[model samples]
Target: AQSVAQPEDQVNVAEGNPLTVKCTYSVSGNPYLFWYVQYPNRGLQFLLKYITGDNLVKGSYGFEAEFNKSQTSFHLKKPSALVSDSALYFCAVSRNSGGGADGLTFGKGTHLIIQP
Candidate 1:
């Protein structure tokens, strides 16, 4: 089955410091990877995606991710963290257009806490 796992339940980082949220996936054949951010009570917003080409993909809000096929991982990163960056992040994977569903399969999500 195609699935994504986020080993960390939460990530705490000081403001202005670098931040990372880990993600790993299991899928058949090549996979379609995606990252999403969710604020309080709001729906998930699209961050970035790795479909074909480009191992390193940049996304909204100064966020970026690198797709590593060997490790089957895609980790989200930011050069500097901000208080506003504190939110829930999810890593998703799709085997074939939504990974068999109408959409992708999302991880449990990691709560990012940016301490000022």
Candidate 2:
């Protein structure tokens, strides 16, 4: 089955500093990479995705990710951090075809803490 792994349970960063949260994935075919953010007791919000183009992809809230085939990784990054950016982050993968209705699989979660 296609799956994603978020090794870290949490990340702490200072406000206005760059931040990152790591993710790795496994799938049968070429993986579709996605990043999502979640606030306290709220549903996840879409961040970015890597379908089949450039390795580096940008997304909402000034966030971005790099897709690395060799490392099987899709790490999320931001140039600067904000206290409002402190939230739960999730990495996801979708099958190339016919995997499921939505075909999305998500990681456990990673809590990002941005200190002011």
Candidate 3:
């Protein structure tokens, strides 16, 4: 079984400051990690994914995450925060392609609030 944990229910940051949304996961075999963001009433948008490659992976909107195998963590980071970046962020994990019964298991979600 695979699972993800978002310890923080919300993260508050100033518009110009940097922000980070933490995430940790547990899984059998190699894990496939992903980040997605959702705006009010809109569908979730894919932010980034870590399948295999460099430890640090970059994604949309100047967001990046470091895949720490030893720690079993994938924490999302943004060098500079923006008011528009405020949204519901989710961290997910799966051992496979995330289909059928083997679908991706998502975290409860972290509300990123960027105050301008």
Candidate 4:
């Protein structure tokens, strides 16, 4: 089975401060990792993904993640957080796509509270 874990239930950061949301994944084969953020009454927005090639991938809203093969981790980072950045963040993973019937296993979302 494939799964991802976001250890922190909530992460608080002051505006303009750097922030990080940790994620670790376990999979049978090569993994496809993704990060999504959800705001109040809104749909999940794609933040970033780690499929192949680069170890560090940048995404929308100045967000970026590094795929660490040794540690099996893909932690999200931002140079400076904003109050609008406050949202529920989720880390998800799935087996490498092979037209298989495997679905993504999502982590318990971590609420990122950015204090202004």
| lDDT per residue (tens digit) for residues 2-111 in model 3 | 88999999999999999999999999888889999999999999999998989999999999999999999999999999999999999999757446456779999999
Per-residue error at 44 for model 3, in Å? 0.5
Alpha-carbon deviation at 53 in model 3, angstroms: 1.1
Residue 61 lDDT, candidate 3, scale 0-100 = 91
lDDT of 2 at 81: 97
Measured with C-alpha atoms, the lDDT of residue 98 in candidate 3 is 48
User: Please, what is the TM-score per model?
Assistant: 0.94, 0.94, 0.94, 0.93
| Per-residue lDDT of candidate 4, residues 1-116 (tens digit) | 77789999999999999999999999877888999999999989999988899999999999999999999999999999999999999999975556776578899999999999
Model 3 C-alpha lDDT versus the unseen true structure: 0.94
**Candidate 1: stretches off by over 4 Å:** 97-101
Candidate 2: minimum summed lDDT over ten consecutive residues — where?
Answer: 95-104
- Candidate 4 — which pairs collide? none
Native-to-model Cα distance after best TM-score fit, residue 32 in candidate 1, in Å: 0.5
lDDT of 4 at 25: 93
Candidate 2, residues 1-116: lDDT per residue as tens digits? Answer: 88889999999999999998999999998787899999887888999999899999999989999999999999999999999998999999986677465578999999999999
Mind giving the per-residue lDDT tens digits that candidate 1 earns over 1-116?
Answer: 78999999999999999999999999998988999999999999999999999999999999999999999999999999999999999999875754456467899999999999
Q: Which lDDT values do the candidates have, in the order given? A: 0.94, 0.92, 0.94, 0.93
